[model samples]
Target: MNEKQIEGLLEQHGIKLTANRILIAKVMSTLDYPISMKELETMLLTMDKSSIFRTLSLFKSHHLVHQMEDGNDIVRYELCHSHSEEEDEDIHVHFYCEHCHRTFCLNEISVPQVNLPVGYRQTAVNYMIKGICPDCSHR
Candidate 1:
């Protein structure tokens, strides 16, 4: 995405646009799947780890990004595709390929809704499936 697009997205999510935040958001916009902190750090060598984490935290609070734990217990972050600022439309099942150690977003596969008991609340849901990817299986 271009700087203008990124700026508009951030503004839509009620997040302040800064150089670091814009850079982070731009990098994330180009990714096809969720990314862990380590991988993001590797890609963003110019920025420090804490800065990235801080920006991610802000993004999550503003519903600009989705944060979830993968099969390996590593936290991954992805841009939220929901157009509405009040709702998150990007929630879906994620697949962790054992062979490739990569996480894939199954956008077509909807996450099963959960029925909570009385007085129970659900803030977030993470459904991760672990298996070999198509490439690994083909090989």
Candidate 2:
């Protein structure tokens, strides 16, 4: 998506349009996988640390973004493509490239229902698969 569309999405979440928020959100939206802010910092041209953090906080609060845990504990962020007004959490598969450290959201794969005890609270679900990504495998 273009920057304008991204701006609109951010606005939908009640977030003001700022250069850093737009920049970070654009990069996040463009990703085929969840990515680290460090990788994000590498991709950004003019970014400040506080701005990225604030943007993430806003995005998460609005359910516009979801955090995924890869094996490395980076607390990666990906677009909650399914998030809406009520913010219903769905179970989906995430792919992680060990060599390149990229995480992909596998929307096509859905998680099976699991039995839980009574009064269980499940806010979010994150399931990840790890291997070398195709690009890294050929390299």
Candidate 3:
């Protein structure tokens, strides 16, 4: 997205717009896969590590993005596609490919709804499915 569009989104999510913040958001928008801060650092030509962390912190607070820890044990992030203010803290599925070591959003592969134990409470369900992706499968 352009600066104006990114700025508006940041405002909508009650986040402050900075150059680093906008760049991070833009990279997430461009990718159909989840990415690590390190990956983003390389993608963003002008990013500084500290700035990226701050931007991610703001994004997490506002539900502009979501983080997942795959079996690979890295914290990866992707844009939250839902426009609703609610369910911002809900659990979603993430797909990770071992061969490629890339994570993708499984938006349609939502976590199945089930009853919780009488006294149990749900916070978030982070489910990561690991396998080889199409490209790797072809090799």
Candidate 4:
């Protein structure tokens, strides 16, 4: 996405527009998969790790981004596709490629619905498929 579109998304999510945040969001918009904090830090070398972490935290709080643990024990973040303010309908399946160690967001494949007990409530859901991705399978 363009910088202006990224800015609009941040604004829509009630996040303050800052240079570092914009830069990070722009980079995130260009990515096709969830990224770890370490990877983001490497890509954005000019920004300090703490600042990036803080920005990510802020984004998470605002529902602009979602975090997931990619089987390797690394926390990764991806932009939220469902911008709903009330319910998190963006909960979708993720594919973790064991060979490349990459986490991909299967946006089209949504998480299945579950019927909880009378007193139970669901806040979030994570459904992941672990296998060799197309690239790895081809190789």
Candidate 5:
């Protein structure tokens, strides 16, 4: 996505637009897979690690991004496809490639709803499957 589109997305999520935030969001938008903080830092050479972490933290708080753990226990971030600030519509299963150590969003597969016990509440769900990805399998 372009810078303007990124700005619009941040605004939609009620996040204040900054050059660093827009740059981070822009990089995230260009990638199809979820990225870790270290990977993002490598891509965003102009920004410091702390600044990126802060931006990601802000993004997570606003629900503009989904923070998830890959099978290897590394945290990854992906843009939330939902348009509403109060509701997240893009919840889905994730795939972790053990071969390449990459995280992918399985958008076609939906997360199954679970029945919680009495007095229990559900806020989020993370379902990750680990295996060799298509590219690795083809090798």
Candidate 6:
């Protein structure tokens, strides 16, 4: 997405269009898969790590992004596709390639719903599948 579209998205989500936030959002918009903090740091070398982390935290809290653990001990973040700021419609599965050590967002497959026991509450869910990805399988 272009900077203008990115800015509009942020504005729609009620987020301030700061330079750092815009840069991060732009990068996230261009990437097809989730990205880890280390990867983002490598990509945005000029930005401070703490600033990036703070921006990510803010984005997640505002439902502008969603985070997931890929069973690799590192958390990755992806832009949320929800229409409203308070709602998150990006409840989908993630695929982790054991061979290449890369995590992918399986947006087409929705996360299955689960029934809870009495008085039980569900806040969040993470569904990850680990295996060889297409690239690894082809190799």
User: What's the CA error at residue 129 for candidate 2, in Å?
Assistant: 2.2
Off by over 4 Å in 4: none
lDDT for predicted candidate 6 compared with the true structure: 0.91
Task: Rate residue 27 of model 5 by lDDT.
Answer: 92
Please provide, for model 6 over 11-122, each residue's C-alpha lDDT reduced to its tens digit, 9 standing for 90 to 100: 8888998999999999999999999999999999999999999999989888889888986979999998776688787789999999999988889999999999999997
lDDT string for model 2 (63-95, tens) is 878877896788888876654634735558888
TM-score of every model versus the real structure: 0.94, 0.80, 0.84, 0.92, 0.94, 0.94
Evaluate model 5: give its TM-score.
0.94
lDDT of model 2 at residue 26? 84
Model 6 stretches astray by more than 4 angstroms = none
Per-residue lDDT tens digits for candidate 4, residues 53-136, read 999998888888888898788899988865654556577899999999889888889788899999998766767799999999
Kindly give the stretch of ten consecutive residues in candidate 4 with the minimal lDDT sum: 81-90
Model 4 Cα shift for residue 113 (angstroms): 0.7
Q: Pull out the clashing pairs in model 3.
A: none
lDDT of 5 at 106: 91
- Candidate 3 error regions (>4 Å): 84-86, 89-91
> lDDT, candidate 3, residue 24?
82
Clashing residue pairs in all predictions, respectively, total: 0, 1, 0, 0, 0, 0
Model 1, range 64-93, lDDT digits (tens) per residue? Answer: 899999888899999997776666877999
Return whichever of 1 and 2 wins on TM-score: 1
